[model samples]
Target: MPKVIAQIYPSLGGTSEMSRHRPIGRDPYAFHTVMHGLRQIAQAMDELGYWGLSHVEHHFHSEGVEVSPDPGLWNLYLGQYTKRLRHGQFGYVLPARDPLRLAEEIAMIDHMLEGRLFVGVARGYQSRWVDVLGQRIGVRASSPGDRAGERRNKELFFEHFRIMKLAWEKDLLQYRSRHYEVPFPFESGIADWPAAGLTREFGVPGEVDDDGALRGVSVVPSPFQDPHPPLFQPFSQSRTTVAWAARNGLIPITTFAPIETAGWFAGLYRDEAARAGRDYALGQNMGLVRSFSIHRSRSAAQDAIERYEMLAWREWYGSFGHLGGFRFPGEEGQVPRPGEDVAARLQQVGLIIGGTVDDVKRQLDVQLSAVPFEYLVWHLPYAVMPLGETLDQLELFAHEVMPEFGMTPPEPPRLRVPESSRERPETRASEG
Candidate 1:
């Protein structure tokens, strides 16, 4: 049976309705509501038997879309409210962060969650935040078109990724690369007299040399999970990334690819893993991320997609060229015109599944049969859906859809409310 993970995109609800407030991302009350809704989702998913709950890491969203800036903190906060559900980010944009700090934070979070943590890293695509945060390191965000920027970003991403893994797996760490040196001066090391004796006596061996120079650093309180928690790379579309992930034993979550593309990537990953001496079935170490809307009627499901998802694509993701992912193999260069019904296009390719229980089940059956993916990530658009509606969809899928795939929850869902009270008034209007 496949593990189901809920990927939360924390958009501040009702941004379109609150024009006077403009960017609801800055509204404390709205932010509070989103945080509370996250808690509610976490608690509910724990009961619904979700394997994990994940969030995204983005910043400076004054327009109130994808406002989850600190996913690690969110994981620590939500971990307290649920026992069974693992918490993590779909990913942290690695090029924009100091990998050592990220490693330490993740380790602490892992301990706090009592081994219920996973780590995800990404080569960032958003310049709005990434360029600003990465300015200190002279790093810039890149997309497929920016060849030079993309290469630089990949270099930083790969270097940072290795450093984090070393911190988790090794007792003492010393690293050097084009962008970073662990001890600042790699050759000389830190010549500090303070705490040298204490560290030599108490810390891991070789942390300080005989002459009292700090030779290596130790990332304290190693992860609660053995060695470290599972690592993941999200929205993995390229063949290069799949091969790298396979070699490193990191699960690659395919979000934008169509089933045919995803299946090809899965096979590539399997072959690469075998070459790396880690043999696996076609989709055993892979995940697929999909948006879903389960409703009583197919049209109603389509309506939900238009209301909750299309606006975001039109205003945000489309501008970033992400909507192109919905294009079929031959239509890779096609771009949607203004006012195009992108929701329908997405559905035509089966990128976003929608319909009644049976319809959703059938669509999933077809898609899953193609790849046999081991993990299914439910990408929830929390900004547009009310807490009640989101819960309703989760419950519907957990009870009706998951069983067909052999995913049985330990306990029945316990958060069903009367239909009349499900839509909170503040979130009734769709976000712009």
Candidate 2:
């Protein structure tokens, strides 16, 4: 059976931080700090025996979130720090990045992790980001994410993904597409020697197109995992995304309204997979504790939760938001800020966990037993709490509550695997 592969993205900001292309902090090291802390967290998780950690990718976040443009660096950093902790990126927004460059970097990370990396790919959604990349969201902006600019970005994504796969799997690569093409011939003297067997499987190697150009092409250091690390699509709460993933055999990470809601969506995804004749063996972590409070003590937690309620009201329910006065983080044209119906706003998205770690655990289990999510990530914004406080909550969760959830920190690379074998493919593959 595929063990549950859950990703915990301890973002600096929460949903509230999502605004017009703004990130939580201006300091460049915001992401770096998170990466450093993640190693510690991963170390703890390994000690406690947890499974995986995934980082979020966003161009702009509301208040306390960190957007990682160069996630490859973080991946490498974490990969070097922990031995067996599975690392994931909840996707690199396709159009906002250079596909080929991203492909090489992603391949390197895969090699570094010995294939423990799972990729989540999506078309850039926010208008702010799309614009930054010089893409347009025009009339489609009104439609939901998948519908707006969906076709172009998805096409670009698939095109890039296919190309990346070809580059990684093939020896001398030849690609000719409308927008991109590269041909390599046999005489290019490309040195391709990866320690991992999976690298050879990723592409078909032969230099030169019919034009007979020297094949100097090779993806350096093939992926560390076998075959290839999976490609997960962000579930858009749409059958389109789900069915597409099901048909294509993609793993998925999605959000649920609450515990019961999570179970329902997971069942939907599983059913779609089954119906599509795809492997049900693929794992899913579709639970999200969005904009929730995790506090060192009950009082702080309660106060934060109340503030979240207020935030929900201020952002979504209040009249200022409703009449189309404002726009979503990635929207153009303009939308009303929102109307105030604080309770209804809270009702819009449920806060399933609030009280204590134990309280959170009980609620989480109730949802997990039904939906069986492989991972659950929390969205603890920086609005109400300080970063230090958030860290305490994270530490506490790692030390106290994670054990109940059957998760513990990973062992150091040396203890987890023989140091001599760290350079060996056998060691990395087995770790996965």
Candidate 3:
């Protein structure tokens, strides 16, 4: 059986704002309440033998749906409180930030966790994040009328990722791409001109040398894991991206899509890995994230899920309604259209695994039987559920559902990179 992980999209009392129909009841310390609740959830998952916990990164949201700006920061905070549970970013939007800084941060966090960090990178989905960053980063200005902003996003994502990989594996890094010119001069002569190295030319006080350009730059403190930490791509709906991830040795993660849709994407990854002459293990790499709730009765579970759907799914489906889903029971060969009923959309998408223990167990059995997945990340601590109920739900999952699947918290992977040697260069100065 694969590991069962917990996934959280932390809320800061904003659920009420997203929908009045299922408003989050007033709490004076909603922000503090959510943080405390998350800590408890992390502690419980650690004690209850959960494989790990993963967080999502979202920003500029007034709706309070997702309050996490940097999932890595949250992962670091939770790492201190948990004993053995791994921490993951379910993901970070690659095109929106500096990948080199991200790599260094990830390496630091991985070391803090003793090499238990799992990284998931994505080309961002939200228009607000991508467009705003595109303008701020001058991508939108440079590439006018390109895929309405998607072309630059994909290009930047790949370019940044390429540099990040080099930062991890290379001793000295310099690269050139259509999008970026890394370490501009391509070589730093500090080794030869130890006294005067580009320091005077750039007007910075240092080991002075005009010959040294912005070159020989490397992400110091290389990752604790050999080569790099485990890399994952959170959204696998795109066949092109799935194939790319597989070829580049990244685990592809899928959720909210139909079972068949996820299965197809996973299949594409496997095929690509095979073509690349790499052995692909479903239990080690393939991940499926699903929203779930197990209750005393099926009707009780359904009612609770419906309330949550109003708060979350309505907005989600309304915004991303073009995806294949939205059908009545037994309805086949129907294409999804926008503005469909949220309940129908949820059902069609197989978005929730809510019901009694037996009901959820059955759903898991069916899905697992079809997809030889290795990781099952349960979306929990939903906004509609009170903190107490959410904790109970996680405990219930740990005790009842995980056992049925023969799941257990996995042992921490043995680190392959030399830890002490990497830390020795912590104070090494370099170019911007």
Candidate 4:
């Protein structure tokens, strides 16, 4: 059965009433609402037998949407409330962060969660925050078009990704890339370091040279999982990204791509993995991201989709030209214009599945059977959907639709009493 991960958008209050409040993202009440809703959803997912739960990382959402700034901290907060449900981001914007700092934080989070952690990385597209945060490194955000910008962003992403891997897997790191140099000034290294002697004595070997200069640095607190946790890369569409992920053993989660397009990427991933000496079946290490709404009737499901998803699609994502990628197989041309029915277009492409339990099962059957994806990332618009409705949808899917795909709720864990802690029958009788 494919593992199902719930990816929440974490949009601060955008309800009709709350929308009146300017910049709801900054509103204390809205913030409280989102936090409370997240806790409820986490508990529901844990009890519903979700394989994992994740959130996105975006910033500067003064308009009160997609306000998840610190995904690592959010994951840590949610992980404390649930047992069994793994936590992660859908992913962190790599170019906007210091790779070494990110590595250290994720490692600490992994230990805090007791290994119930997975990681995802992304080449950021949001200029609002990415450009500002990455300014220190001379990095800029880019999209599908701008060839020059995209090239630079890809280079930075690859370099930072490598640095993070080195920090996780090795005892000490000495890296030199276009954007970074470990121990600063790779040729001369850090000279006259106060802790050089102590680092050499207590830290990993080769951290300091004979002259008491820091040569290599060790990233402390390696991940709880050996060699780091499972890595994922979301929104993968290009062959270059897919191939790189295959070579690096990262799961590529494709979103907005039609089934045929996704299958083509899956084939490329399989071929690339084979070339990299890690044989994988088609779709074995790939994932698909899709939005869904389930209800008793198809029309009700459509209403749910409209109430929960359409505003964000039309106003937020559409403005960025993201809706352009929602084309169906063999249906070529521009996406719906400003006044067109974006929801209809999404349904036509099967990107947004909505209907009764049977209806949803049939829709998913078509896609999952077509590509045998090992992971299904279920995108939930929790910011707009009411808590009760959201829980109902999750319960319906977990109990009804998921079973059609051979998925079932896991058995409740049994608490085992240690032999030394158990009471003896003779001692109990004497006490009585």
lDDT of 1 at 111: 82
Give each model a TM-score: 0.91, 0.68, 0.84, 0.92
TM-score comparison, 1 vs 3, better candidate: 1
Q: Give the per-residue lDDT digits (tens) of candidate 4, residues 1-432.
A: 788998887776456735587768788888887898899899888988888889889988887778788988888999999988889998988877889999999999998888888899998998888888888877788765778777888888888899999999888899986579997989899998898778888787888889988888889788888788789999887888899999999999988777888998999999999999999988998899888898888999988888899878888888988888876667767877556698988888788888988889899999999999999998888777777888888888898887778764433333334354476766788999
* True-structure RMSD, every candidate: 11.3, 8.5, 6.1, 6.4
In model 1, where is the ten-residue run with the lowest total lDDT?
409-418
- Across 124-225, the per-residue lDDT of candidate 2 in tens digits comes to 555655656544323121124456465566666667777776765664556666645563222343244332234344444443222333344565555554
RMSD of 2: 8.5
Question: In model 3, where do residues sit more than 4 Å from their true spots?
Answer: 14-28, 140-148, 185-214, 281-284, 322-340, 417-432
lDDT of 3 by residue, 1-432 (tens): 878777777765435544652333233355567777788888988889988888887776655677677899889988889878889988888887887898898888888888878898877767666667656675432133466566777778888898888889886666776665556433453344443433444333432334533345656778888888889887666678788988899988776576777777777778789899887754347888778868899888878777664565565535654334433335566445545566656654666777899888888788888886888877664554677787888888888988888888768777674665576577454321
Residue lDDT tens for model 1, 189-289:
99975998899998889989898888878887778777788899998988899999999999999977688888888999999999999989989989998
Task: Return the clash pairs for model 1, or none.
Answer: none
Model 2 residue 84 CA deviation (Å) reads: 3.0
Alpha-carbon lDDT of model 1 = 0.85
Give the Cα lDDT of each candidate. 0.85, 0.54, 0.72, 0.85
Backbone atom clashes (below 3 Å) for every candidate: 0, 60, 5, 0
